[model samples]
Target: MASTLHDVARLAGVSIKTVSNVINDYPHVRPATRERVEQAIAELGYTPNLTARSLRSGRTGAIALAVPELGLSYFAELAASVIEAAEEAGVVVLVEQTGGDRDRELELLRSPRLKMTDGLIFSPLGMGQDDVDRLDVPYPLVVLGERIFDGPADHVTMRNIEAARAATEFLLRTGRRRIAIVGAHEGEVIGSAGLRLRGYREALDAAGVPFDESIIGYTTLWHRSNGARCMRELLDRGAEFDAVFGLNDTLALGAMRVLQEAGLRVPGDVAVVGFDDLDEARYSIPSLTTIDPGREWIAATAVRTLLERIEHPDAEQPARLLLADFRIAERESAGAALDSASAALESAGAILHQGAGADA
Candidate 1:
């Protein structure tokens, strides 16, 4: 037999209505009374019947989260953060992965399975600006990622251009002039790769450093294997680069591994930097200096915004474009070590030797 709401009320010496108020999170409940009710519920090991509560509230007390791929560290961490935030709000999260396929993403938008939850938080990768109309769903939907902006739903994403610019500027300030880029998509202009590549170009233009296309490595995916392959190609082509900027940490780590295999010292032969401050980035060899793109805030904001939409479906609030602030996580991969006098001398000596037609 399971303890009921009446048992909780009896243990707390309160009315059934009072216990219900606390469980339902009514804002007017007195602190002492709410605490007493909560303590009693804990003591009795009472669990609220979600089905019964849903009958009265007309809400399933659950939300759906759809992402491109959980195998990717950034998406994996984002999902974990979303789950944490939903758990804190006493809501359940059903996760779905689309493998970054456009057709699957469109199908997910129209899927009848979404009726099980009150709202959805979607992160699409394969679907681009062309699929913007598909986002006008009839539910409380919050869209994440760098795709299909200004749609009919609330959007939560990072400032990719500004953050990528900051990352590039950081490398330049470290006395690196010939910076190579990994994980670039060929002829792209709207996705993450395009936006971030634009930022890198902006930084170079501001610093009066001419962009070198030869050192720009193109990849179809942002995976470690792609990063390694890109770096190898750049090396084989004899692209002269003093620093490498990987679009993401996984790619950066992969490129760094390849650089080591080629007997090049990181930050000594070629300083390295990456984006997406993943937890694994902190534990990698020499650690990764990357961008902390406020993924946790994005998750929390997405949940809160979705809940607001769910609570006030007819409130006529216009869709919002919420952008998360980002900062560079300075670590060993491209840290103060590069600013040392010896490193500065080494870079200057290499440049001087090259100018004098001498082998470095």
Candidate 2:
């Protein structure tokens, strides 16, 4: 038979209520008392019955994570990270995929299944500012993405505009003019697509480079397929471009493949850069220069925030906004030639030094 709460309470020389308090992470419990309770629970191998606990506290030992699509590498990685963090907190996670469709996303917001979990971590792609009011539901919630800022919940997101600006400026500093941007939203003004496009324009404007609308490729999705299709369309239009900036690493890899199919050498004919420092980005042919947008931090923080809200409901909910720090992952795609030339120069200089040492 498994050890019970009574066993933990008896071993700790405390009442069952005190043991329950400690298990629930009640802040008012004294440190020494909490430690004794924890040690007792550990020694007795007592695992609290989640169903019984739920009946008493009305909180399931699970949380919900709803994302647009886990098929995307970035989201898949994020979901894994969230699950890891939640496990550390002694909680289970229930994941839901919205397919990035507006109807499905909205329907999920009103999901009866939400009541089964303690809270939700939502990363919405379809809902916008107009749907902010609808998020004022009963459950504790943390919102992700740039679709609706200043919403009535804790928000965690990457600094898309700032990161995008840094990526575009990097390409410009590499002496790549006539840079074409893949994964642009046609009329979006607040989402990731729009924010990144705005950033690219800012970089070009700062460098005194004229913005050519013809060079911007529009896509409804940010998938690899969308990137390839958009690149092909751009090529057919016969627009001149010296480099491609993909909004995400997947898109960048797709565009790189299509560029190669057209017999253009990467970084020789057209340098390539991307966002999202995915695991696959490092293994792509020529490797990809991309942005590491602090994804792990975002995942950990989102889980932590949701748990805090769930555990401390009476605590002031101040609609906190968190942005992930971003850095460029320099790789072979954009600066391969420059790196190879530097390596050759170093080798030549080493040979010259060896000869000089021999003469001496």
TM-score for all predictions?
A: 0.83, 0.82
The lDDT of model 1 is 0.88
State in Å the error of residue 16, model 1: 11
Candidate 2: the clashing residue pairs are: none
Weakest ten-residue segment in model 1 by summed lDDT: 351-360
Cα lDDT over the full model 2: 0.86
- lDDT per residue, candidate 1, 1-360, as tens digits? 789999999999999999989987999988999999999999999998877887778799999999989999899999999999999999999999999999999999999999889999999998999899989998999999887888999988888888888888888877899999999999988888999999999999999999999999999878999999999999999999999999999999999999999999886788899989999889988888888888998999999999999999999888998888777787778874456763564344222111111111
Compared with the true structure, model 1 gives a TM-score of 0.83
Worst 10 residues of 2 by lDDT: 351-360
lDDT of 2 by residue, 113-173 (tens): 9888999999888889898887787789999888988888888888888788878877776
